[model samples]
Target: MPNARSVVVFDAFGTLFDVHSAVARNAASIGPASVHLSEIWRAKQLEYTWTLSLMGRYEPFWRLTERALDQALARSPEVDPVVRDTLLTSYRALDAYPEVPGTLARLKARGARTAILSNGDEAMLADAVASAGIGGAFDAVLSVDRVRVFKTDPRTYALVEQEFGCGREDVLFVSSNRWDVAGAVAFGFEAAWVNRAGVPDEYADLAAAMVVGTLDAIR
Candidate 1:
């Protein structure tokens, strides 16, 4: 639970936005492999981030996204190269989850300061927020690009305190990705795991402060 002064920081991809919707939007062109492509693309994107961070190397998340898509396309050769451009373009404006706008509004109406702390690059976050028409909802959109790394890294999580001058306990970090919520918990933030899929929890030692089915359930 967040206190009145707690800044509600959301993870962008799976929490606020429906990342799989990019492939769903172009399903007609992707054919039966659409689901596999989305799964592989997302998995590889995160893998690349961790791999790069371990190697003390960095690539902008946008580049990792493209590289991951290429890998997914290669694995699903049934998907035509022609739809590649369409899929990539759709990622820039991926659909927001139905409750996002109203939830953000309610939080703001209650005087909570909201923000997004994402692995997405600045430009990617800007485009997605603009496309969702929720560009003004956040007080800050902190990207890992600022630190040249990705989440699970303490430096990435540190951006919250850096931005708001708040202690870890003064933040409620929300993410649909359990690993992200675990990372926030490890960093000492009051974390909420938005378990939209009703999946069993992992990272038992670093459990979230709360778990909810959706953003609307926060508070």
Candidate 2:
């Protein structure tokens, strides 16, 4: 892993925020199987992100997520419009995982420079950070909108190094997604896979600096 003095950059959605919780909160109105619906909604949302990236047809994350949700809902028309609105409203205030505040505090206390590199828009991310009550925890919050590209793209990862005013080697990047871990490594940042789901076997060749179960485990 990079040295402790190096800046640490994080992926916003899965790394810091409990995006699943937001979905779970709204899933009930969308269908009878609320949890399952939320799972499918998340899967489709990510699928659309990667698909759009590969197709070189980029859209904002909010619009893309809404489109993916609509498609997922079509498979289950029994889903209630009220539930959909509930979930959509919930997006405006996603909860951070329980470990987040303490972990961020630890990093900040150590004088580590921290930033969020997310697929979300600046406005959306700003609100998320503010509502989470951790807006002051980060040195900066970067969005893909600035580069018009998503994670796994070299340009997206470059933002981390740029914002920290450091070389890629001077940053410690953390991500829960395997592809994102690989991309950050490829971009020359020392990367860590916060494999909270225990799915690291697929990324054996990616040479991450560390593999921890959660943000709290990071040193």
TM-score of each: 0.97, 0.92
Q: What is candidate 1's CA lDDT for residue 187?
A: 91
Model 1's alpha-carbon lDDT is 0.92
lDDT of 1 by residue, 72-97 (tens): 99998888978878888999999999
Global lDDT scores for all candidate models:
0.92, 0.81
Q: Compared with the true structure, what per-residue lDDT tens digits does model 2 show for residues 1-219?
A: 445745888898888887788766654444466766677778888888888889999899999778777776776666764566677778878888889889889998888888999999887898889989999999999999888878788999888767767887678888888788888888888888888888634656667888888898766
Q: Which candidate is the best by lDDT?
A: 1
Error of model 2, residue 150, in angstroms = 0.9
Cand. 1 TM to true fold: 0.97
